[model samples]
Target: MKHSNGAQLFLRNDPAKTAPLSTKKPLTIGKASTNLLCMPQTDGVADHHAVVRWSVGHGWLICDWGSQEGTFLEGQRIRNCRPISDGDEIQLGKVGPVLVFRLAPASSQPTPEPAVKSSAGGNLEFAGQLIPMNQIKFVQLLSRPRYPASFSWWALLSLGALVVLPWPPAFWTLELVVLAGWIVLGSRKEHVLLVTLLDGMAYRHSFANKVTALGHRNGIRKAIGQPSSA
Candidate 1:
């Protein structure tokens, strides 16, 4: 069955569990009675944690409700509000539940081509890479960098090591030098295209990255046909 141009939220740990969002009303996700979507009783989730709403102007929007643990998109903590697209991962709290967002099939969508050709053995071409359709467990299109370009674990550890230095000027100078080094070594930001294999390993591709979530969804549909049975 085909759906509309909405979104699907899938539980990362449990792929069978899902929340389909294609409505006008905001979907409330939390661990309490008032929420429309009740998450499992777990640490880090507040009584009323976060909300996913749809607007004609913005498409989909995710907002945090000032929880103690906080909500995260990809890996960055959400501050006020952020626009969400297909294939984006939303992590609740620091070690809380993880949800993957996907674009729903539109009602007017065309019939998908066969996922595999009997003679060719199901090969798919994506982002200049040849993928075996049967081996792909999932596909995600990322518009932003998952990790902060300027932040690194080595930089943080170096800063911690400098705590033993004298406070007046030695510590300050080292801090500035470390910060400059981090900036100089920062990596370039590019669009990320991820393909997860059945063995749980993932392949990544980076490029010009101008495609929208919906555009990626359509492309995947054409490449792999309809969604596979879970």
Candidate 2:
């Protein structure tokens, strides 16, 4: 470690091994690193895949990937997530080891805290309706997903596959089933859109008429000031 004026810098063979130093001046590391690894959002995650995946931020990435050996942090072997630290050795699953971490320049200022996002789950509320947690799954199954883009491609691919298939058992049932699924997926998108538009119009008209009627009733009731029903 060396100091110039009021700033200090640390040089290390491995940036991941450097520890955070407290300081009064803002410290800027040439490169910062952390052991916590986050993988890409995709690549599959199911109840049964064995290996789990998690995402951090920046360039940090971690994956059990399919390794049975697993990753570790502190002293605990993490089966659900990769290890992360201000500075530490990364024992990357079974594929040997890779040292990774954020390298912060030596500092005189108090070590700044990393930004963290809220991981808390929130509730969904509908006007005049309070849905209990247990009923959420039932409602979700009844609802449709947004922006499903596979239907059109499925339709195209199914058609192409049908053309290439020979006659009999293979093409006979499978082709029709594929076509049905493809069609169902398409119609679902259209159905959802139509329902949304119809509901929007109905809601608009219903609210407008309701407000107008309520206004008239209020006017009459105010004139009387005795008792009125709307």
lDDT of 1 by residue, 16-57 (tens): 777867444777888997787786577778888998876433
Candidate 2 TM-score, true structure as reference = 0.25
Residue 84 shift from truth in candidate 2, angstroms: 3.0
Task: For residues 41-105, write the lDDT of model 2, one tens digit per residue.
Answer: 31222212222111222212233434445454433455544534445444433433333344343
User: Where does candidate 1 stray beyond 4 Å?
Assistant: 1-6, 106-230
What is residue 210's positional error in candidate 2, in angstroms? 34
Distance from true location, Cα of 27 in model 1, Å:
0.6
Candidate 1: C-alpha lDDT: 0.69
